[model samples]
Target: MELYKWSAQATGLGCYAYFCWCCFLGSLAEDINESKTSCCCISNILAVYRMKVRATLKIRGDSFSDACVVCWCPFCAGLQMRNELRNRGLA
Candidate 1:
């Protein structure tokens, strides 16, 4: 289960799940580079640079508006992702 309810928003119709806007954008760019590099880019923008939450949410670039959401909102989406990566020693 996902910790952040807002993290998995429905992209299209029929309740299909899509990542949050920032992550969604990053995932779209996943094909252009190495997976590790891509993850690094996103993570750097969301967590390391701004309000580091319990879980880090990475985006292809720094989307400050969304970052603020992750930072201020108690139900932060980034915290969930950050923990998963950290548990695996990936973050």
Candidate 2:
């Protein structure tokens, strides 16, 4: 994942997420749910969505592992998703 490769859009998203992570989560969740990208703000649903993201990105992990990552550090996960999507021209 291009974690350090922040475009203007990603930079803005990172800033927003850094300050209002909950709100950012909600926004990202909506994007994930409504757009071709997928996920949700709720922890349970988000965990499931994280699995989908893993599949979409071809990342290696199980449901429990993805859940743990999302639970512990959703912002990082979101940022990674954003970068991946942008990289694939899917965002």
Best candidate (score: TM-score): 2
lDDT of 2 at 13: 67
TM-score of 1: 0.24
Worst 10 residues of 1 by lDDT: 9-18
Residue 61 alpha-carbon offset, candidate 1, angstroms: 4.0
Candidate 1 regions with alpha-carbon error over 4 angstroms: 1-58, 72-75, 84-91
lDDT of 1 by residue, 1-91 (tens): 2343223332231211133544543532342222433444553454433333322434233457556654664133444444333444544
lDDT of each: 0.38, 0.62
lDDT of 2 by residue, 9-47 (tens): 334368877887666666656645644233333566667
Quantify how close model 2 is to the true structure by its C-alpha RMSD in Å: 5.9
Per-candidate clashes come to: 5, 0
